[model samples]
Each structure stands twice: as C-alpha cells, then as structure tokens.
Target: MKEGPNIAAIAALIGDPARANMLQALMTGVALTASELAQEAGVTPQTSSFHLSRMADAGLVSLRKQGRHKYYSLADADVAALLEAMSGIAMRSGMTRVRTGPREPELRKARVCYNHLAGEYGVQAYDSLIAREFLVEEDEKLVLSSSGRSFFTDLGLVLPSNETKRRPLCKSCLDWSARRSHLAGITGTALLSFFFDQGWAKRVEGSRVIQFSKAGDSRFHEAFSLQN
Candidate 1:
C-alpha cells in the first residue's frame, strides 16, 4: 500500500474466519467480553484477545473496561454498515456458505443492525413511512419530513434537544437479508428504542434476533400498515 487509505489492511483483518465471526457477533450492538467473543469465534480466550487487539488497533473494534472485564464492540456504525454491505454482496453473488443456522430464519424476519432495526419489519416500516410522506428521498439522502416529526411525536418519541448534530436525522441502511433499504441514523435508533419501550419486541439473549410477541406483531403490522 502506498501513502493513502489502505482498505486492504482492513480486509485482511476481517478475512480471518474467527475475526469475521467476532465482528458479526458485535453487529448486535452489544458489548461482549473477550471470553464471550471467544465462544462466538470458536477460539480460546487468549486467541480472541489477540485477534481483538489487532482489530482494535486497526479501528475495527473498540473496547471499554467495566470493572475487571473489558467489553468489545464495533468501532462505529460505519464498521457495522460495511459488514452489512458485504453480507448483501456475498448473498447476491452466491458466495454464501451452505446450511444457514437455525436462527437464520428468525434473523431474516427481524433483527438488530447495530443500533437500528433491520430485516423484514424494518424494511416495511421504511417503505411505509416513505409511502405515507413521513420521509422523502432527495439527493441520495433520506429526509424526514415535517409530518415525520408529528408522526414520531404521536408515537411518544421526542427528538432529544441535545442529540448529536453530526448524525443525520434520517438515513438509509441496506438490509443484508432483505436486500432493501432500512431506516438508520438518529431517527431509526429512536424508533427502535420506542418499540422496546412500547413492549412490542425484546432482544433474544445471546443473539441478534428481536422477537415480537403475537400481539406486538399484530400491532406492528397494523401501525405500519404492512399488510402487503
């Protein structure tokens, strides 16, 4: 690599299967300890720490110490976005491994992508919002309309006054499983939190799945008019 940004370095780091697994696990937006990551990577704790150290040095992962244990998470939403994009390309290109996991179906139905909702329900919500004029696309960017503000407020989600201005109010993230766009950014994060607060869904332990109860699922579909 010359004196420029080197994607090859990042690619090489993520190319290892164990490291890839660790990164995928972090896509759930949960900080995991070295031992927990080792279990996900099918590696020993020492090896997990070694791999984690390299990724952290490369800005692929970030670590925080809680008590005596250090928990690791993706460095940022950009890293998670990159991995999600890669997964889409791999699936579209037929480069996927055979025999998806038992949880794969649930994941495809609904899951968390970093700090936002993803999969079928997420896609539906994004589409519905656009159709209802809650959001608009302009100049390759998602813009939350004035109606969107009212809609979200009615749902009991008020935009924080001190929310970081660096992040957009609305953004689109490509869903890996659905191969479609899902809402992201500050608004997306707020909506997902709203779902939890409304008791519409809960995160599955040790996984990325967001399981909605029967009534919750019905309410979700009705609220979003996703009965297509």
Candidate 2:
C-alpha cells in the first residue's frame, strides 16, 4: 500500500461530473445553499446533499449556517488553488467544454478566481508588478519589494507588515484562460476589493465576470501600465 497521501481518494471525490459542476460554481467565491448547488450540478436536492456531506467530511468544502439555511463554500484558498491548477492542466491538454457561450470572451477578459482577480487583466497586473519590481522572485517564492509596499500604500491599500503563517501576503496563481501567473493571496484579495470599492469594476450577477466601466478600464490600464 502507498504510504503517502491518498490523492486517488480526493481525485475520486472531485471526479464526479455533478460534484465538479457544483465545485466550479462555488469558485465564484459565493457561498451557496444546497438547493442552489443542486441547480448548478443539475442534480436533485437529495443528491446534492449527499455530495455536500461527503465533501464536507473530506475537508474539501466548508459549511455555514445562517438561521435555518446552510451555505457552503470551498474549504479555503488551497482548494481554490488546486482547482485553478487543474483547470490550467485541462486547458493545456485541450480538454475543454464543447459548449461555449458569448460570455466566454468576457470571462477571458476579467473574472474572479476564488477571491482574487483572474483572466487577462489579472495576468497583466502580475506581469506589470514584476516588471516594475513591485514583486520579486526569491527562493522561488514571491516577495513584495519595498517599492511594492509604497506602491500599494499610495494606491490606498494597507499592506501587512508581518506575514501570517496561515495565508501568504503575496503569491502567484496560475490563470487557466490566460495560461500565465496572476496574483493570489491576501494582497490579491485586497486589490480586487479596492477595485470594487473604487468603482473600477463590478462583478456580474450570477457569474464570475468582472465588468469594468469605460473610465474604470482606462484607469486600470494606466494604474497597471498595461499597453493598449
């Protein structure tokens, strides 16, 4: 018997089509009820409950109770990161869904990955930060430079002085659609919140797409020094 982690068991849990759909739907970073997840999975409520129970036991998903209603979300950033990495592998392998929609372009342009920005703009942001030396690679890990601290602070983001053991301040996430690295972690989450707070972008209802207004789009490019 293999002594290491049982990846096969976790893979089997995620391998089911209905559960996969439900998990993907939660990638929007919104807590969903079993009924909502059932709709997303295209399964009956009872089936959704069963899958949720299994996932909850496996620590793949977390559940919360709001009054009489129960809501579920991915366990943590690790689960989201795993799903994103898997998506990149699937895309590279040409294992794509046959059904494509008009929103595909929008999704590729800008979308939410868990709690952080992803897609084209997300990739561009990471690239720009690296190019400007705002983020530097050291020992194969991302480190926010002193200049990066000033940059974000000037932009009205409060940078953390000490890194938490539980979550990173700066980390790279693989973008499935752009096929590149994007910012993820506490800083990334803060940046996305800043955009929404400043009205630079807004999340589309019932979807992961982030719609930037015309002025907001211009400002985003200018702020990130993204070439037109």
Candidate 3:
C-alpha cells in the first residue's frame, strides 16, 4: 500500500460533477447555504446536503451557522489555491466546457479567486508590482520588498506584521485564464480589500466577477501603471 497521502480519495471527492460545480461556485469567496449550492450544482437540496457533509468531513470545506441557517465555504486559502491550479491544468489540457457564456468574458477580465483578485486585471496588477519592484523573488518565493511596504503604507493598506501571522505576506497564484502568476497571500487580500474600500471595484451578484466602473477602471490602471 502507498504510505503517503491518499490523494486518490480527495480526488474522488472532487471528481463528482455536482460537487465540482458547488465547489466552483464557492470560489467567489461567498458562503452559501445548501439550497443555494443546490441551485448552483443543479442538484436537489437533499443531494447537496449529502455532498456537503462528505466535503465537510474531508476538511475541504467549512461550515458556519447563522441562526437556523447553515452556510458553507472552502476550508481555507489552500483549498482555493488547489482548485485554481486544477482549473489551470484543465484549461491547458483543453478540458473546457462546451458552452461558453457571456460571463466567460467578464470572468476573464477580472474575478475573485477566493479572497484575492484574479484574471487579466489581476495579472496586470502583479506585473506592475514586479515592474515597480514592489515585490521581488527571493529563494523562489515572492517577498514584499521594503519599497513594497512603503508603497502599501502610503496607500493606507495596513499590513499585518509577519511575526504574528502564520501565512506568508506575499505569494503568487497562477491565474487560470491569464496563464500567469498573480498576487496571493496576505498582501493580495489586503490589496483587494483596499480596492473594495476605495470603491474601485465591486463584486457582481451571484458570480465571481469583480466589475470595475469606468472611473474606477481608470484609477486602477493609473495606480498600477498598467497600459491602457
């Protein structure tokens, strides 16, 4: 018997089509009820509950209770990162869905991967940070430079002290659509929060899409020094 981790078991759990749909829907970083997940997965609520129970037991998802209602989300950033990486592999392998919808274009433009920005705009932001030397690669890991600290502080982004946190301050996530790395980890979350707080972008209802208004779009490009 193999002595390492049982990846096959986890893969089997995620291999189901209905559960995959439910999991993808939660990638928006939104907690969802079983009924909502049922709608997303095209399954009955009872079936959704069963799937949710299995996922919960496997630590792939976390559940929250609000009064009499229960909501579920991906367990943590790790799960989201895994899903995103899998998506990129599927895309590269041409395992795409047959039907493309209008939302496809919007999703490719800008969307949320868990709590951080992803897609084309996300790649642009990461590139800008690298180009401006706000972030640097050291020991094969993304590190926030001293200039990055000052840059973020000047932008009113309150960064968490590294000594107090278990998560890295800077990390890179591979964007599925753009096929490039984007910012992730603590700094990435802070940056996305800053955008929301400043009203530079907003999440689209019932989707992962992060829509930037015209003025907000301009501001984001100007701030990141992205080409028009």
Candidate 4:
C-alpha cells in the first residue's frame, strides 16, 4: 500500500467534467452559488449540488453560509495554485476545451489567477521586476531583494512581517496561457489589490478577466516598463 497522501483520489474528484468546470469557475477568486455554478458548468442544479458536495468533502472547496444561501469558493490558495499548474500542464499537452467568444482576446491579455494578476500583462510585470533587479532568482528560488522591499514600500505595498512562517515571500506561478512565469505569493496578491484600489483595473463581472482601461494600460507600462 502506498504510504503517503492519495493523489489518485483527489485527481478522481477533479476528473469529472462537471466538477472540473465548477472548480474552474471558482478559480476566479469569487464565491458562487450552486445555481450560478450549475449555469457555469452547464449542469442541472441538482447535479451541481452533488459535485459541490463531493468537492467540499474532499477539501477542494469550502462553503460559506449567508442567510438562506450557500456560497462556494476554492478552499485556499494552495488549491488555486494546483489548478493553475495543472492548466499549464494541460495547455502544454494540447489538452484544451473548445472555446470561443468575444472575450477571448481580453482573457488572453489579462485575467486573474487565483488572487493575483495573470496572462500577458502579468508576465510583463514580472519580467519588468526582474529586469529592474527588484527580484532575484537564486537557485531557482524567487526572492525579494533589498531594493525590491523599498520599491514596494514606495508603492504603498508594505508587506507585513511574518517571521514564523516558512512560505516564500515571492514565488513564481506558471502562467498557463502565456507559457511563462508570473509573480505569486503574498506580494503578488498585494500588487493586484493595488491595481484595483488605484482604479487601474477592474474584474469583469461573472468572469475571471481583469479589464484595464486604455489609460490604465499606458500607465501600467510606464510604471513597470521592461526598458527600465
């Protein structure tokens, strides 16, 4: 008998089409109701409920109660990271679903990955940081340098000090759509929130896309230009 965590069981739970769709929907970092998820998954409400129950039981999702309604979201950042990595693998392996819509280009340009920015713009931001020497790659590990700390502070993104934790302060999250690496971890989430707070980007309703205005696009490039 295998003497470690069971990957097969978890994979089985995510292997179902309906469940996969529901999980993907939750990847938008938004809590959704069963009915909303059913619509997203193209499944009946009863079927969606069954799948959600299984996912919750397996720890893939969590339930939140609000009055008479229940909302579901990915259990935590780890689950979102797993899905993002799997998506990168699937895209590289030529496993894709048939998809087409007006929002396709926008999604390819900018979208949310778990809680942080992703897609072309996300990759660009990461590259700019690297080019500017704000982040350093040491032994395949991403680390924030002294200058990076000061830079973030200047941007009003002062990271909370946590000495007891072992998690990396800055990590690379593979960008499935762009086939590159984007920033992840606590700093990444903070940067995304900054964009929202500054009104530079907005989440598209009922989707994972992050829509940046024309002015926002120009300003973003100015702020994180690779040439700098």
Q: After superposition, how far is residue 213 of candidate 1 from its true place, in Å?
A: 1.1
* TM-score of every model versus the real structure: 0.95, 0.98, 0.96, 0.94
Q: Whole-model lDDT, candidate 2?
A: 0.94
Candidate 3 ranges with C-alpha deviation above 4 Å: 163-166, 226-228
lDDT by residue (128-219, candidate 3, tens digit) is 99998899998898888888889889878989777324478888999999899999999999899899999989999999999998888998
lDDT of each: 0.92, 0.94, 0.92, 0.89
After superposition on all C-alphas, the RMSD of every candidate to the true structure, in Å, is 1.7, 1.2, 1.5, 1.6
Superposed model 4: Cα runs more than 4 Å off = 163-167
User: Model 2 — which ten-residue stretch has the worst lDDT?
Assistant: 219-228
In angstroms, give how far residue 116 of model 2 lies from its true place.
0.2
lDDT of 4 by residue, 99-199 (tens): 76788788879999988999999999999999988999999888888998898898778886652244557878988889898998888888999999988
Candidate 2 structure quality by residue, lDDT tens digits, 1-228: 669998999999999999999999999999999999999999999999999999999989999999999999999999999999999999999998898688999999999999999999999999999999999999989999999999999988997787776689999999999989999989999999999999999999999999999988998998898553
Candidate 3 local lDDT, residue 38: 99
Question: Which portions of model 1 show Cα errors greater than 4 Å?
Answer: 1-3, 161-166, 226-228
Q: Pick the candidate with the highest TM-score.
A: 2
lDDT of 1 by residue, 1-228 (tens): 369888889999999999999999999999999999999999999999999999999999999998998999999888988999999999999988788889999999999999999999999999999989899999987888888889888878897544454578888999999999999999989899989989999999989999998988988888788444
Best by lDDT: 2
Which residue pairs of candidate 2 clash? none
TM-score of 2: 0.98
**What's model 1's lDDT at 88?**
97
